[model samples]
Target: MYVPNHLKWRILLAQELKQAYFERENSLRNCKRIFELYGRYLLGTTYDTFLTYLNQRKYRIDNLRMPPYIVAAIGLLEPLRIASERLRLRKMGSPWTLQEIVEEVLTILRERSSTPLDRRIGQAQQHVE
Candidate 1:
């Protein structure tokens, strides 16, 4: 099954935070704040709930070291990405259900999780070329 982009972004942000910045309490706090803020905006869920969900899945950010800037970027990009996906779904006019949207987003997330940096950059290059 495909993971949605929104979910993918969340996972990526979490992973980055965990891997790169969770070591320091300060960094963890920043990452937590960013996650809560953006997660609320995008998923209509509270930060605590998001944290709970991660915990349920055994996802931990402790001991990671994500830069504050990158965390901020993830927080900034998530809502924009969700809005874009929603707009595209609306334009497509197929399976206009929220469930469909969620599924599509999940699929995108799953696919993108495995996407390499170079491929992502290449895709960006194509967009600007």
Candidate 2:
């Protein structure tokens, strides 16, 4: 029987494809056994490798510093608390103007200067001279 050239080519191609399929199927039979024995280990290795890759990429994208908003809040929050404490302390005391506060501080300093230890120091200086 004389087959056409195109038919012969088609038949050859079909046989080649069928043979490749069987070879691939036979190769996968070994893989099937290997996977059945070491499936959990292989999966764990793959998962760990993928997790490491993701962490590397994440650090590259944003090195593990605090977010900008959190930093801003920390910067603002402490000063606000300090100011609130200062206001509360001011309210708790007698209401004194700036000049009164200066006068009070000067009086306290003067009283300290008149202590016996200061007078003794002054007398020691005169004797040394």
Candidate 3:
């Protein structure tokens, strides 16, 4: 299914926030408190900005679902979490550049071919091997 890039970013951000906060505390209260405390940093923008961006893109923020782009972003961010502290301590690069993220998401979608012909070709090749 086709998914918007912004939705992907939102999903990745949500996953990262969950991992960073709720994974350790494992409490809804703690999760909520942590979300309130660090949500701005995790989201990379203010709530108003987020809403505005979504609105500009004609995307509904209320029903955002996790897209493949977001899944890829989460994969990328997993390793970076180790350096998150250092990042906070010093000025650093953006975690996910707009161009890079979009490119990655597109690449992922392009690579996700599921055509019967493609599968047949793959099966034929497997038989040959």
Candidate 4:
């Protein structure tokens, strides 16, 4: 199939962003990783422009159309939660490991999702693993 110039550009951009995200040191400082991982479901890259949009409240968790626990699991990976002074969630854990956290979040999302589509996707993922 012949791809349009605009779509090709978008595909290139997404690939570039994914590459950058995967290459990051897997820490809260690499906020783009969150967006790269969840941008499709979240509607856009929420963490990519978080600093300026923090108070804007542009991205609502409800927009994800996912279970609350999945949302919460993803929220746990947010830089704000990790950096928060009150909860200090990041420090509460033994160590901050982004890969482990991502895996845990995926497991939570897979186990908690109610939709048939999500379940099928999870099943397919499990089969691949």
Candidate 5:
């Protein structure tokens, strides 16, 4: 939940591209407010989380303003995450089962979706079809 040292930075300048979407005056608050990328837990606010979405985007002298969208190698990153979690569990000598792993992996991916799932993964019917 801690902001990494590398991600923390002070605003030397503020440029609001949005049409009055932000209070330009707030950026000129004239204070050395400390901002650690609250969400910048790992790689400058993407690898980990700590702040809620509202707080993450709400700009303040002390808040970190992340990009509107982030392009990630999720296809690779997600599988990597799955593999890493598996590796950690394996190292901890957690009992292993493909079924449990399958369920956990699905849950991890589902967490990414803000909407209900519409696709199937390894349904038996699909294999038969």
Candidate 6:
């Protein structure tokens, strides 16, 4: 299970936030907000591949800080990303059974977890690329 590209940054950012600011319960509590503000905003965008663009700019830069407005912009951008994904998936097909829907949700949650998974069969494909 190769992790999806959109999720990579989310994972990395979550790791950072947990390390810096959150303990277990707080981390779980804020999970949804974190995803809404950061993860989903980044879906389908190659922006996350560029280290300099992440909130803390972990590897690409030192001491320089991301602007507050840029962070706010990410939150602002998430709804469009979510809406378009909804449309795209709707066009694909419908889940005819409750089992299918439950399975899909479980699969998504698993993918988002830190458990090691089999790498996807092909080279990573970036949405922007």
The candidate maximizing TM-score is 3
Q: What residue pairs clash in candidate 5, if any at all?
A: 37-40, 40-45
Segments of candidate 6 deviating more than 4 angstroms: 1-29, 32-65, 93-129
State the weakest 10-residue window (summed lDDT) of model 4.
54-63
lDDT of 4 by residue, 26-101 (tens): 5455545545554444435445443233333333322234345644444454433334332345457466466655
lDDT of 1 by residue, 2-101 (tens): 5554454565454553443233437547657656545566456666766654554444434445568876665436444675577576777554566665
Q: Distance from true position, residue 13, model 6, in Å?
A: 7.6
The regions of model 5 sitting more than 4 angstroms off are 1-77, 83-91, 115-129
Better of 1 and 6 by TM-score: 1
lDDT of 5 by residue, 1-129 (tens): 645433233121112211112233453231111113112322233221322322344434455453443222323334445655875666587665666666666777666554534544334346445
Rank the models by lDDT, top first. Answer: 1, 3, 4, 6, 2, 5
Per-residue lDDT tens digits for candidate 2, residues 1-129, read 654543333333222222322223354463343333332242333433323432332223232344466444433433444444555586676564666554555555566567899788986677556
Q: Clash totals for all models, in order? A: 23, 0, 0, 0, 2, 2
* Cα deviation of 124, candidate 3, in Å: 38
lDDT of each: 0.57, 0.42, 0.53, 0.46, 0.38, 0.43
How far is 99's C-alpha from truth in model 1 (Å)?
A: 32
The positional error of residue 122 in candidate 5, measured at the CA in angstroms, is 31
> What TM-score quantifies how close candidate 5 is to the native fold?
0.24
lDDT of 6 by residue, 34-70 (tens): 4445544444334333222344433433333445665
Candidate 4 stretches with Cα past 4 Å from truth are: 1-28, 45-50, 55-67, 70-129
- Looking at candidate 2, the ten consecutive residues that score lowest on lDDT are 14-23
lDDT of 4 at 7: 37
